[model samples]
Target: MGATVEVEGLTKSFGSQNIWRDVTLTLPPGEITALLGPSGTGKSVFLKTVMGLLNPEEGSVKIDGVDIVSATDRETQELRKRFGVLFQDGALFGSMSIYDNVAFPLHEHTDLSASEIKRKVGEKLELVGLTGTETKLPGEVSGGMRKRVGLARSLVLDPDIILCDEPDSGLDPVRTAYIAQLLVDVNTETDATILVVTHDTNLARTLPDNLGMLFRRELVMFGPREAMLTTDEPAVTQFIHGSPVGPIGMSEEKDATPHHLLGAMDHLKLGDVPPQIQPSEGMGERAGAVRHAERLRTTPDIEELVIRQPDKELERRPVTRPAAYSAPMRGLRQVGSLFALALDVIVNIFRRPFQWRETLEQFWFIASVSILPAALVAVPFGAVIALQLGTLTVQIGAQSFTGAASVLAVIQQASPIVTALAIAGAGGAAICADLGARTIREEIDAMKVLGVSPVQRLVVPRVLATMLVAVLLNGMVSVVGVIGGYVFNVLVQDGTPGAYLASFTALAQIEDLIVGEIKAVIFGFIAGVVAAYRGLNPSAGPKGVGDAVNQSVVITFLLLFFMNFVITTLYLQVIPAKGA
Candidate 1:
């Protein structure tokens, strides 16, 4: 169904800090509207309010005649289902493949079968000119590609209304123009109502059927594009022209001007210049009449092109068309695309291996730098376990078994799990934090634009690297625990080193080492992907990187413990015991 968005007398405030107050606007169906404003002016907040992601303290917003804020939960959900959002940073889950990201809404919202999902995802990727990059993670592609993938994902929902937050923020001039043209073309084709929030005046000026400026907790201006663009109002004019002088003030500067300069500027205006406006010379006389006659010959139809230029000017420049995706057909294309993506991923894994480098650095820091902590833990822990078992042996008149008890407690269970936890605390958090920071800095976005999946490119590599480390760390723990226990055995019970080794060998089995290996493998993947995913979804700007980093470590630790427990339960209960 076609949709229209209408907001009435919206008011929202946090204590004394008002974001927007009594803001009202009507966005007609089948047109692009831009919410333009300076930074911190609440453009994003307004877009969020429209999306029903936020509720105003006082106001009513209706999409297709349904009141979003007052609607039932089901109604609210249905309302959201009608609209698609392209977050400023793409917001593709780092752990998921590009194909999975595009297919997410379909999977979540529909009961479509796997084959159907693949077809739909392929079509959307083709729509965004990303046919073969599906299996690759978001991190491997460039910024532009990531944004396009975000657009493709938004389109997968087949939304009649699209909400884009800062769609053109970091792109270059050419890419920005391409995006603007793409939006217009998409709107023309699909007739979707689009609302874009951006601080870029070029995008704001060239696009949009209607323009609105958020300021001082309210929309100070709202109107048709041409009307707003041609206005000389202080706030609107100053912002549009990139001027520093306006009602906006600086605390350190006093407002003073040369009276003569102001007077001369005022006196030189108006009719003295004999009107600077000029009529189009190319469409004059016979040509104008011919065009007018041709217009009458055909049905009246006018579509707003964001860039208005003469026919002659356009004829001279080569026109670039938006990439189109063919409707999916037979089995071959589906299989082919999947194969291509897999090949791309395999190639990328060996290409740069950035995450591999990071993992190696992380492993080095964890194992080498953390030696003191390991020693501290092992010495006390080994001594305590040995002493406790020795006291119990004396009570039972079996004091010789102290060496065997220490070997069972420290070597079989304690060492592997403890060392794994330590490495997770040290290395896992670092991995997550590092990746998360890169994501916020747009480094991940860079990879997406280059048609590389950050997951395939970054996460897979890191996962592999960490797995190797986990295996190595477990082996190291076995060695350290043995040495630690042997020292305690000799010092306390006058047990020989040979006896300590002999007892450990007698009790330990290959399966125990294998169990530890399985846990490490899972832990490494968990830590790597968690960190990568958190990094890729970081909030806007510099501070968000730091926030993502901090959150990644905390979340990774929790997940490690949770996953370890699940693995342990499966090993103990799900897998048959020796007798079973």
Candidate 2:
């Protein structure tokens, strides 16, 4: 099935800054088109917008005569099914096996039974030349293999159009050639239109039927692959030849050339005519002929392209596993990895167990970093709860209940949530940032190759440390907030400290403290794990590390809040709020 995708005058901006403007292109059916751009040129943003992952401020993208930009949510989803995407990082779910990863879309969108899903997943894996590796995790595979898995996943749905974003990044030349060849083969076999976003000039020039480049947030050129690539145009020549001296400049400097300068970027002329591609009709041709004969019955004009003879079509010089792991080895590796991680965690926990140095460090950070918000919000909040409780106590002529109310509020709700958030921002972001830096420097990769489990060496220690510190921080928050509440009671409500302390102890149950401590431990472990996961998967460079830190805090805060509600609900239902 062929598909034609059109992006008409697409535009998007953030605040006062325009990301891209008036971007227009038409991708013909049954062909591969390349989208090329430098770093930070909004390549990803444009792709996301095309996929309806982001809404453009202006214009529309139509797929096979359907305008996705104007579509409703359901319509957009339906449109998305027509196109499959392979993200740069593979983006496989870390928690699933290879088979399940490839089978995810089918499971979610189809009514296929277990047997059918398994069969289909196995078939796709075989197509990708990854048969017999069903049980492997993505982390266990090389980068090239992961990309194949990603490609397999994308093809499982038999999508009419495929969108690949930076599919050749981080891969060797041989792997890049293989991937390009695979795409060409698939395009021929399925007659599916494909769009690839990339920066590799050779890969781009050699692989696609059409080419386009984004410069200055606009399409610098777009045309037949041969026409665009083998050109004397200064800009196109400079880019295709990988030259630093060109119309483009480093650090945002623009050549004030006239806008209407036609072919300003084209600098070189075509010197040689490449040869044409023709697949061999070998003894194996009998099978293809038989298939072609069969296909002719259903539809005529089934021209068979010999898989091997496509040099001209291939844009010149380009062109171009495993087994069930042994059960014992797998188990031993997993267990040893876990144990080593546990040992490292234990060592880190006891390494500074004087309870003064690291504990004080945590205390100072939690207090200093978090005190501003805590003081601003908690003090006023305490005052409100106190005044409300005090008014009720006075009306009932049982003024001592004000202390009971303050104690319950702080012990049950305020301290745990406040402390978790504080730790999430301070300790969690710090860990995420640090680990992210290590990941960028390839330290984690080095450890992995050296037979060290990153999870044990890195994750276990950080999680254990966080949980240990959180236990103490939760206790401290409770005590400090309670004292602040009593001070608030005395200064604001004129209640005596002795009566306040006495009433607080009388009404506060041990269960409250136990619940608070349990919540802290859970939150701390979750925060640490989340921070480490995000950091370990940090983006390609420095900005990616910052993003990891940012995402870690956000996701940690969300998870902490969610867990708080869940635990609170369970506590109320099962524990009965201490003799309620």
Candidate 3:
């Protein structure tokens, strides 16, 4: 049986643009409910909010008895498994064949064998009329076929809830009708609760057991199909007739000047509400309808608004805008978010099915781009330190001490800082840009809807790679800088060669090198996490991605230097320098 969904007092806004407000609706279990909205009313956003992909400012989305908005990550993820989503345009992976696409959830969640997986995939494909098209890629199929394929994928898990966003978007009238009937067949067979977001008039009139319409940011009306279609509401009348006259807020025009703008809407009655679609042969009576019939006996006169109160009162407080955070509070919130994400990554690292391949790939990429820069920076940096210290020591009649000073500066400060900056500028920026691109493209949301945590699947491996590569790069920088300083002091500054080598070990302890490596690890982790965070939260456009990349680099640099100061201070205090 389908899970009952209760959404109450829901409000969502992005920046200053309010999409919808106080949206309260109940989807009867094992039924089809259509949410109709004009193009920009955030029809799709509502679906995502209910799925917990987007958080509403003031409301609760309770699936069965669990509220997704307040659920823990583990709890939220568990709840998501019960939902199957068919995104508009299919949202299929371009690289995978249809067979693999439908089989993704099975691969992610279940322990089924290859043959059993194949049989299940076949059954779902056959049900959707795509059985022989399994081997074909999504690109090879037409738009209507892609939608059917998406439908098939949604059913593979036999989910208790299904969400369809604009499934009739690009289809012709015949194709749309066929898909509408197909939905009825699916409802009858699976008995899964389904919510579809679309603005197709024909589909609204015929397909769903219940209907709701969104106009000018509010749900004008919602109830059994008959209640919505036979209404005299201007918005409903104008919408059903596809009339341009008397737009949602123009009720005055109907009374003052009704002839031309109003069209034939006044003369034409909606006749009779179309009979609800029935299941095809072999699929029994719709379970939701039987339940709906029984519910109508006591249903509060469907005439007034708020026809059915859900399981409980959703809001304990009056709806209001979420409190705005001041700059300092916002900063604290960001810090807390980053810390939480870091903890999530740490916990996920120990879980099975680790992302070793992705980690290794990122490691190699970071290493390749960083080695030359690390060496280049180290050589110039160490040479300058050596020359400056040599000149000072010679003037003070203590030229032998120049090597010790330069080595300490290079290993204790220069090596790890240089390695970290290189990683941030090269590899960290790349990670940020990659994630920003994915974020803007809705790919990350797609992964979230599919029950794949972007943090676990993508961030964990990348962060580990950054840390590992940072450690290696720090060692390379330390060695290269020491050699560069030695060569510069002996050859350019005309310092004694044996004195330079001996003096390095005199003042520098083993712990100095170990601490530098430790700093590298911390720096790498911070850089990777910062980059990943920025990448995952870029603004909504190409320009936004570019800005996030810049922000990641800037943030990583600030954090790296601050951490460097603290670590250097602590290391000096804890581990005494070698004394003569």
TM-score of each: 0.55, 0.56, 0.86
Q: How accurate locally, in lDDT, is each candidate?
A: 0.65, 0.70, 0.83
What would the per-residue lDDT of candidate 3 be over residues 1-580, giving only the tens digit for each residue? 8999998888888755667777888898998999886667788889999999998888899999899998997899999999998888787766679999899888998999999999999998887778799899988999888888887888888888999999888788887877788888878878999999887888888888788877655666788887778876666777777766545433422332223445546754466888777888777888888887766666777675334322223322333444554456667888898888889889988986898988998899888888888889999989988988889999999988888999899999889889878999998998998788777756677678778988888899989999998999999998899999999999998889989988977788889989999999999999999999999988879999999999999999999999999999998788877873
Q: Tens digit of lDDT per residue, candidate 1, span 364-386?
A: 75556344555566666777777
Q: Where's the lowest-lDDT run of ten residues in candidate 2?
A: 302-311
Clashing pairs in 3: none
Per-residue lDDT of candidate 2, residues 1-580 (tens digit): 5688888877776434566766777887777778876676788778778877667778899988888889875577677877777876776656568898788788766899999998889888987789988999988998778878888888888888888888888788887877777777777667788889998877776677677777665666676665565555555556666766566566445543323343543344444424212122331222222332354456532222111111233223321101223466655764465445445555555553233543445445544655555445555555666777777888999987779888888878888787777778877887888778777754564233222345654566667677876787778777777777788789888998788878876677898899999999988877877787778778879999999899889988988999999988998888765445
Winner on lDDT between 2 and 3 is 3
TM-score-superior candidate, 1 or 3: 3
Give the Å shift of residue 475 in candidate 3.
Answer: 0.8
Best-fitting candidate, scored by TM-score: 3
- Model 1 TM-score (2 dp): 0.55
Best by lDDT: 3
> How far is 50's C-alpha from truth in model 1 (Å)?
2.4
Least accurate 10 contiguous residues by lDDT in model 1: 270-279
